[model samples]
Target: MLTDPSPTRIDEATIRALPKAEVHVHLEGTFALADILFLAKENGEYLPGPAATLFDITTHDAFAAPAVSTGGGAGAGAAGLSGFLRFLDWQCGLVRTPAQAARVAYAFAARQSASGVRYSDVIVNPTHWNAWRGREIALMRALSAGFDEAEQDGLCAVGIAYSLLRSQSAASAVDAVATLASARPGHVVAISVDGDEKVTGRTGEKFHEAFRLARATGFRRTVHAGESSGPDGVWDALDLLFAERIDHGVRAVEDPALLARLAADGISLGVCPRSNLTLGIYRSWDEHPLPRLLAAGVEVTLNTDDPAPLGSCLEADWAVTAEQFGFDEATMIGFAARSIEASFADDDRKAALRSELAAVVDERSRTGALSS
Candidate 1:
C-alpha cells in the first residue's frame, strides 16, 4: 500500500506536535497580508493593492507596470519571485514605528507558539526603521517588551539578534553594534550581516572589522553567506567575518573541505527548508542538502526564515524535513539536540533545554507518538 518504503513518513499530526527551536526567523519576515494591511492602515501608508489582492500581486513582474491594473502579479493560487519582492517592498510600509514593531514581534511569537516552537531567536533589522525615524532606542525597548510579553504568555522564550544590513557602511554597522552593546537590551544575542548576499560577498572585508569588535565585546556573530554564491562567500564569512553561525549554508555541502571545516569549527547553520524551496534554492525538498549536512555531522537547525510570506510554519518545516529528507524519529530528536547544542543560550539553559527535550521525546515514545 505504501508508495515507497521509507523510514520516515512524516504524517501531518506527528510533525505538528514536534518540539523544536526556530533559530533563523526574521521579525519583519513574519508579516502576513492581513497584518500588513492593518499596519499600513494604521500608519497611513497606501498599499499597492487591496488586502485581498496583495498575494496576487506578489507574482507580478519585477519590471511590471505599477498601478496599471487592479489584478496584479500572479493570482492567489500561485506566487512568483516578483510577488515576493513586492511583499518585501510592502514590508517596508508596516515597520515604521516602535509600537508596530512590538506588536509584530508579539504576534510573531504567538504564531510560533501556535506552530509548536519551543524557543526562537528572532532577527530584527533596525536599519530600515532608523532610515524612517532614527529611533533605534525606542525600537529596542519595544522589542524587549515584546520578548517579555511572549515569555509571560508561555509561548516560548524569545531572544533578539540584530541583523545589520550589509548594504550599510561599515561605520554604520559599528554604530549599530555599539548601540546594541551599550543599550538596555545589552544581552543582544548576536550580530548578523544580512541583505543581498551578493553585496556581502563584495564588502565582507569592510564589515569584518566591525564583526571582530562585536565578537570582542562578547556579541555572537553570524553572516548570510554561501546561500547566494560559491564557497568563497562561506570562506569570507568564516575567515573574514569570523561568523559564529552561518545562515543558509546549503552550499557548504558542495565542498567537502568546507563541510569538514564547518564540522570541526562547530559553527551552526540556520537551515530553512521551505524558504529554500520558495526561493528556488532547491528544485525540491528531497534535493535539499539538509540530510547530507546532518549525515556529515554538520551542526544544523531547522527554521522558517519567513513564516507568513513563505506560507511556512514551524510544524510545516518539521513535517517536510522529516517526510522529504528521510528523517526518522531518532533523526528528528538528534536534530533538536543539535539545535540546543548550537544555541546561543548559556550552558545551564542549554542543559535544561536538552533535558526537557529528552523528556518530551521519552513521553512521545511511551505514547507511541514517535516510530522508528
Candidate 2:
C-alpha cells in the first residue's frame, strides 16, 4: 500500500495531505521572523539581523554551541544558540510576561496547522524564564495556557517537553529538571536534553551527570547527539542518558553494527532532513541518510527541526523526503506509525493516532485517489 515517491511516482500534493506527527521540533528553533520582530519591538530589544538574515548558516558546524540562559531580556548574542537563537533573542524581549509566551505558543500551533502537522510536542527551556521571573514555574504556566488555547482553536493536542542546554551547570540542569518534574501531569509531557552535542560527546562528564539525574527523577528522555559529532555520541546518549530516542541519529547510518543495534533495541530516530542538510550532514535532500536508515529497519520519523529558520514545514519535510528519496506510500505510512509509537503520548493516545493514520491510508487506497 506504500507508494514510494519518485520523479515518475506520486506527486507532491499527495505527500502534503498525508497525516503525520512532527516529533523533533524545538520551540526556540521555529520562532517565525515576523514574531521575532514584533516581540523585539514590544520589549525594546535590539534584534541581531533583518528577518531575512535569520537562516544564514554558511557552513554545517556553525550551529554547534549550547544555549546560554540569559534573563528574559535580550543577551549579547542573538537568540544565543544557533541562528534559531538569533530569532529567539528578538522574541525574548517581548516574552517577559505569560501573555507573550501564550501568544507565541498559539502562533506556533496555528502555523503548524497550515503545514498539515496533526500533532507536535515542542521543547521549551524554563531556565531563561526563571532567570527573569526568579521563578521557573512561569514558563510552565505560560506554555500550559498556550497549549490550552491551541486546543480550543481546533488544533490537535500540542504537548510540551521541558529542556535545558548543556551549557548550564550540573546544579542548574538539576534545578531545571526539578522544575519540570513539579510541573508535570496537568501540563508538560516530560523533560529532555538539547544543546551542544559535545556536552554529551564521548567524554563530557557534566552532561553525563545531568542526564542521569533527569532519568532518575522519572522523566522521559531524549538528547541531541551524532548531529555534529559521530556514532559514539549516539552510543553515549543511549548508555548514559537512557534516551528513549535520539534527536538526529543519522550518523548511526555510518556504523552498520550500531544501526542493527538501534533496530534491535527499537529505538527511534527523530530525523530532520532540512536540518541535516543545513547543518551539512548531507549534501542535499536526495543524498540524505534517511533512505539508508529506512532500509536498515531503524524506526525513523520525519520532522522540521526548526521550520522558520530552515524554511521547512512539516508537510514540506515529508514531501521532500518522499520525493527526493523515493519513499513509497507504504514506507511513508510505516514512518507515521513509527512516529506515533515512539511518541511520548501514552498508550491510549498512541492507539487513537495510529488508528487514525491507518484509516486515512486505507481510505486513500479505497478511493483509488493515490497517485502512483
Candidate 3:
C-alpha cells in the first residue's frame, strides 16, 4: 500500500534516523578541518593560520561581501564561490598519490555513512585535479578501491559521477567523458558537469558533442545549472545535454513553463538549501524555492553540495528543509523516495533501499515515533 504524502509533524531525531541517499555531494568538498590540518602536516605544507581560519569565511555574515570572479572559473581565486573552488583545488592538490586519493575517498564514504546515508553518488571533477589530470584512470581505480573498502565494511554503498568543469577546455571535457566511459562501469555510474555556472553562462552548446558522446557510450548524465544562473541554464542542461538530473536547479521556480516540463517529464532537482544560503543565492531558508518547487510537483531532493566548506550535512539539510517547509514525516519520507527514484543506483539497489525506507516509515507510523 502507498502511504499518503501529506504533511505530518516530525522532529530532527526522526529525520536523522531515516535512511537516505545523497546524490550531489562532492568528494573534493568533504574534507574536515582536522583532515585538512592532518593532510597539511603529512604534505609538509604551511598554513597562513589555524585550519579553522580557512573555513571561517564561509559563514553567513562573511558572505555579505561581494563575490569577485577571477575569470578562470570558480577555482581561480579565494573569494566567494571562487574561494570555495580554490579550497577544493587545494584539497585535491594535497593528494599527491593514488594511495592518498584512496584514503580521502574512504574517509568521504565513512563520513556520509555516519550521517545515515545508505548510498551516495559522490561527484569528483577531474579538472580540479591538476596533479592527476592525465592520470585519471589511476585516480578512479584508487578511489574505487577505497569505496570498495567502505562497501565491504557495510558502511555505505558508493558510486562516482565523473564531473566536468565548465571552466575547463572542451578538449578536457571530452577527455574526461571518454576516461569515465573506459573506466570500470561499477566505479562510475554517471557523467556530470559542475563549476561556476556564472562563469560558463549556461552555454550547454559548448559541451554538446561531449554529452552526445557520453550518451552514445551509455553513461547517465547530470549537470549543475540554475544555481548562480537562471532558468535558462537549467533549460540548456535539459535541451542540450539531455541531463537525466540537475544539480542545484532551484532557479526553475522562476519559470512556470520549466516547472511544468520538469513535472511532466519527472526530472529530479538536487536542491541544496544551506549551500544556497551560504552562497548568497537566497537570503533565507523561507525565501528558498524548494517549497515552491515541491508544490509544483517537482521531484526535489535535498543535498549538501559541499558539507565542510558550507558547514552543512545531509541530515542538517533535511532538518532545515523540513522545518522551513513544514514538512511532516510523510513528506520527509517522500523526499527520501524521490532521492532513491532519482539516483543512478542500479534497480536492485534502488529496490532494496525503497523497501528499507518504506519499512522504516511504516514502523515509525505505527509507533508514532516521528516526533521528538
Could you say which candidate leads in TM-score?
3
RMSD of each: 4.6, 5.2, 4.4
Q: Alpha-carbon error at 328 in model 3, in Å? A: 1.1
What would the TM-score be for candidate 2 when compared with the true structure? 0.85
Full-model lDDT for every candidate: 0.71, 0.68, 0.78
| Native-to-model Cα distance after best TM-score fit, residue 329 in candidate 1, in Å | 1.6
lDDT tens string, model 2, 1-372? 123447555544666566666778877766677887787777777644444654553222333244442211111122334434433443454577778888888888887767656677777765434334555577678767887898788875677777766566877777666766665634577666666564334533556666676677776787777776679878877887778888888889889988998999999998887777655555676667777888898998887776776666777677666777776777677777777777787777778787777788888989986544
Off by over 4 Å in 2: 1-5, 8-12, 46-87, 127-133, 198-200, 203-205
Which residue runs does candidate 3 get wrong by more than 4 Å? 1-9, 57-66, 69-78
- Which candidate, 2 or 3, would have the higher lDDT against the true structure? 3
What is candidate 3's local distance difference test score? 0.78
Which pairs clash in model 3?
8-328
Error of 2 at 307 (Å): 0.8
Candidate rank order under lDDT: 3, 1, 2
* Top candidate when judged by lDDT against the true structure: 3
Candidate 1 residue pairs in backbone clash: 58-83, 59-83, 60-73
Tell me the TM-score of each prediction against the true structure: 0.87, 0.85, 0.91
